[model samples]
Target: MTTAEAETGDTLTEALTEVLSGARARGGLFHRAVLAPPWAVRVQDGAPLSLACMLRGDGWVLHPAAPQPVRIAPGDVVVLCGPTPYVLADDPATEPGLLIQPGDCCTTPDGTDMCEKLALGVRTWGRDADDPTVLLSGNYQLYGDLSTRLLDTLPPVLVLREGEWDAAVLPLVATEVVKDAPGQQLVLDRLLDLLLVSVLRAWFARPQAQPPAWYRAQSDPVVGVALRLLHEHPGHGWTVASLAAEAGVSRAGLARRFTGLVGEPPMTYLARRRIDLAARLLREPDATLASVARRVGYADGFALSTAFKRLRGMSPAAYRAEHGAR
Candidate 1:
């Protein structure tokens, strides 16, 4: 993927806006709030949020719910889930292994009032953090939320140190990220969005050795078409014949290509997508198993339960009980 690939969804500006909107809509609120010196940043009241691409220069460190203080330098992007209070700090070597929470305030050992807040990128809550979180020397992307499947294959953090890719556009954006102005908050949000996109492009550019079967298939015209359709309509009653037609291939061809590229047949993808959607719906407080089953093409709650258990290794109710928000 090139910078052009990041700009692929629509016109350049529209694609950029769409990326921000996608991140915010999924995450819920886009916090354009600014915190300078004397005020520690607090996200105690929002959904699970992620901060990407925006670097925290000196004077700040991230104190997450986890005890370890994550130090931030120029080009470091971090993601925090839950309403846990993460503070920007002047000192990061204090807490080593305690679970912290929102509203939990601490002091430096000397008690000198240790942190001065700094401008960071667009912070949003409730979005998927599977995108990307990175740090780069030049054209760098600090943080992102691609998809869980993608991130699972990466090192905990991907760092693009110094090169043409780094020098291209990330540094200019980083310089602007450190600037302060009246509407700088707005500027910061947009720049953060671009920085994340750049990171994904970089990831795709330097191809992973032996990319996942799903990603490799995502490039195939037939498989890609099928994937987009499945993602767009997970609730649909997708049949192999239907998917084959949708992808403009024979049923046999589709099955073989799909298995070869996606590492599974069409039905497997459909089932996974359905179950994934069902799992998400189950997590919704208002939805019932029967309704969720119907939505994902199962004939009844029991049937959905059987299949869900097979795929997730737990009954739907148990899964929900342990994991659901409400």
Candidate 2:
């Protein structure tokens, strides 16, 4: 490969890492589903992000966001990237008798909780212990503005079939899901995160993956440098000319290139990133409005509040309250 190709590959890798760094799983749901034929489970709405890997037999993912019901054979992994409702079943025609609520709570459509009744084993659920179909699932329950920003770039669902992704972590997830060890939740959390990162990284590198425009722009040295500056130092008072100087380009050239590649002017993107920073900062209980303002390049609380309210449709205080005051 040429020098520019090598450099662009490096930049893409770094950008992917930076964006995925915030994907902490915490104590979210991780389960191994051992299912029989003629079974279906409806996630009656779900977490911000969840992953499912088919380890045995086959199944289907039915979501409104997808044009067709995606078949999941052995070794296929699917990433569901929105909080919208979807279903996993033996067949697309199967009607779900069970519903999964938030927090991994399983219930009937009539609101009868069945979490304890449906237990097959540790972190394993479904009809029977010796069921033929096995699936590994993990709910990310992602919080943090940075995490949300990452999810914003993804479609509602993405599927990586067998041989299309790196399955390095699949074995580990399968092995760990059925074990009830000390600190197992934490272990599973980390493992799930690793699996997610691996699958997503592979997907992003595929020709048909259709990753976001900004993500694609990360391969351009000039535009990528400009984006990195905006992200790394949202607090910095930046101008198009200053950013262009830092990126080794003329101001007009930077503007044109950034707009063409990222589909937004340089300064507009900066403002969005700054507000994202401010919103994340506001979630900190000890972070005052004025402090959040300064950290994201605003002059004061009022200035930040005006900008924040204008962009986010609410004041910083309101946003903090809505997201929980840390």
Best by TM-score: 2
* Cα lDDT of model 1 by residue, 1-326, tens digit: 67645433333233223223333112222332222323333333333344433333333335443445555544454444433444444345433222212222223334333222212443321122232222221111111222223333343334343341343555666456446578765565565545545654554457444445765555566887787677667677888899999899899999998998877788876786677667667767899999999999898999999989887788998878766533
How far residue 91's Cα lies from its native spot in candidate 1, in Å, is 18
Q: Give candidate 1's whole-model lDDT.
A: 0.51
Residue 236 CA displacement from its true place in model 1, Å? 2.7
Give the range where candidate 2 is weakest over 10 consecutive residues by summed lDDT. Answer: 140-149
Stretches of candidate 2 exceeding 4 Å from the true structure: 245-253, 275-295, 300-326
For each candidate in turn, the TM-score is 0.47, 0.85
Query: After aligning candidate 2 to the native by TM-score, how far in Å is the CA of 227 from where it should be?
Result: 2.0
Model 2 Cα shift for residue 107 (angstroms): 1.8
C-alpha local distance difference test of each model: 0.51, 0.83
Question: Any runs in candidate 1 off by more than 4 Å, and if so which?
Answer: 1-73, 77-156, 160-213
Q: How many clashes in each structure?
A: 17, 0
